[model samples]
Target chain A: MEFSSKVLEKAVNEISQLPGIGKRTALRLVLHLLKQPKEQTVFLSQALLTMREEIKFCLNCHNLSDVTICEICSNKNRDHKIICVVEDVRDVMAIENTGQYRGVYHVLGGKISPIDGVGPNQLNINSLVKKVKSGAVSEVIFALSSTMEGDTTNFYIYKQIQESSIITSTIARGIAVGDELEYADEVTLGRSILQRIPFENAFKNY
Target chain B: MEFSSKVLEKAVNEISQLPGIGKRTALRLVLHLLKQPKEQTVFLSQALLTMREEIKFCLNCHNLSDVTICEICSNKNRDHKIICVVEDVRDVMAIENTGQYRGVYHVLGGKISPIDGVGPNQLNINSLVKKVKSGAVSEVIFALSSTMEGDTTNFYIYKQIQESSIITSTIARGIAVGDELEYADEVTLGRSILQRIPFENAFKNY
Candidate 1:
């Protein structure tokens, strides 16, 4: 880990500060940057600085955006009244990729994890509760992953807006489209069986 | 893979250009950066730019340095007459960590790989040959890895300096210190047996 140059050492230290990257990986990356054209480093550095300084969060959904409100939240044709709650912008992108959901998203930023010192207050939970209580929303879909933290956050939000008249639901947990039934975990298999849709309804999308 | 923010996308693209990083990992890293304080991103960007712009290579050995003459080359205590030829600065650092060798190093920059468009001309081989021809160095140790390209680079350099009145050697190839005999590869185990030194010599360091 001993660097011959102070500048190289400083760069490696900064790069290794990132999650999942170690000193060896940082050294390899820095050496690669050294071998590439100087413009590559310039562009990388400039892009990172500009993004960090100028990036904005959507006022409505809390997703990353270049404007005050994100495109999804601002689209008039989309069903903003039917909000799909997610953990972060990545989930927003994932759900958008599916092209199955036309509703707006309310990015929670992260889950309620006590061990990580992250609670409901630190996320966008309060705003979501307020929005639901305002009676403008007709349905709120909890689309976070099925981990303990995701379930905890979902329950917390459900309790907050339970008195509201809007429908509250979670995305169905089932075996993935291409996955074999036998390969599905026990909990997912059991839940899929318990929540089985009508035989004719399965062919409706097809 | 679609990004809601152009700035975030640009930064992810730049970061993903590094070896071993993919778009998903890049997004994770960028999102992590966004969660951190602005100074963290600023410092990382500044450090990368400064390192790329200001880093220097040693005049004699081509190893990375802040000055024309690296500390190893400038030190009078090390034996300048014995040069350890290595693939890059990483090898130099590895050997330096061992603290067993007293000789200075001549970094080859990289091995000769025709598939990668890397030839001896692209490396520091010419300077090493010229240094050897000067008759100041009495022994040249080949410390490059034992890959095909490494062997080719070694033999090529050996042929260049063969006529000079200097001894040439390569680092030993054998089983690692703590490796179990049963799990050792045949070639490595055979070589270890063939190149075994006197039994008493193994305890010399102790």
Candidate 2:
């Protein structure tokens, strides 16, 4: 991993600091950049710098945005009352891509992971609790993942707004649409059986 | 793959332009950067910009370097008369790491690949041939990869230097060290048997 040029070494060191890239991979990527037109590197550097310097988080949902409020939050057609709680902007994007939900989102930024030193205060929990207490929202749906952190965060938020009359619910956990039941984990299969719905409700689209 | 922020989208797009990186991975890396302190992003951008703007290639060997003549080329201790021809700077680094070859290197930058629109004229072959004809180099070792393009490039260079008294040789190809004989490929195994050295030369270290 010895580099003849200090500049190339510095670039490789910086790039390898990324999550999955290693020193050899960084060298390959840096050499690739060197092979391409200078304008490509210019565009990449400028875009990264501009994004880091100018990007903002939505004040309402805490999702990444270019303005104070994100496009989803500002949209009038989408239902703003029914808020879907999730981990981060990635989860928000995933839900948005499905085109199923009409309610807006409340990005918590991350889950409650004590191992990682992330607590409830570090997340956007207080703002969500305040929003629910304000009585402006009709429903709050927990759409976090099925991990322990997700359940803990869900329970913590549910406790904060349980006394209120607002109906709080969680996204259903079941076998994936096309997955075989035999391959499903025992916990998921058991939950699917316990939470079975009416036949007509199961295939409403059909 | 939908992005809410234009700046974020631009950065992801530029990053995905790199080799082996897709839009999803680019988004993940970009988001990881955003989660870290802004100074990390600044350092990465600055390093990349400086490397791309100021990096140089050795005028004598065509290897990536910070000066006109590389350290290996200028060192009087190394055997300048025995030149190891390689595909690029990576091979030079690999050979340097071995600490076995005291000969200087001549990086061709790339092999002759007609499929990729690369030819002899596009490489640093002319300079190497001129150097050989100057009667300074006594030996030229072909250490390019054992591919069709590599063979073609080696043969092309050999034809130019065959008229001179320079000794020309290619790197030995065989089963790698610590490799099982049963798992060795047929071609390499056959070559190893056919080119078996004398008993005294088989294990010089032993």
TM-scores for the candidates: 0.99, 0.95
* Candidate 2 lDDT, A1-206, residue by residue in tens: 78888999999999999999999999999989988999999999999999999999999999999999999999999999999999988899899998888889999989999999999999999999999999989999999998999999999999999988898999999999999999999999999999999998986651
Tens digit of per-residue lDDT, candidate 2, span B1-206: 88899999999999999999999889989999998999999999999999999999999999998888988888999999999999988899999998779999999989999999999998999999999999999999999999999999999999999999989999889999899999999999999999988988867751
Q: What residue pairs are clashing in model 2?
A: none
Evaluated with lDDT, which candidate comes out highest?
1
Kindly report which residue pairs in candidate 1 clash with one another. Answer: none
Segments of candidate 2 deviating more than 4 angstroms: B202-206
- Once model 1 is optimally superposed onto the true structure by TM-score, how far is the C-alpha of residue B94 displaced, in angstroms? 0.7
Task: Point out where model 1 deviates above 4 Å.
Answer: none
Q: What is the C-alpha lDDT of each candidate?
A: 0.94, 0.93
Candidate 1 residue-wise lDDT, A1-206, digit = tens = 78889999999999999999999999999999999999999999999999999999999999999999999988998998999999998999999998888899999999999999998889999899999988899999999999999999999999989999999999988888899987789999999999999988875751
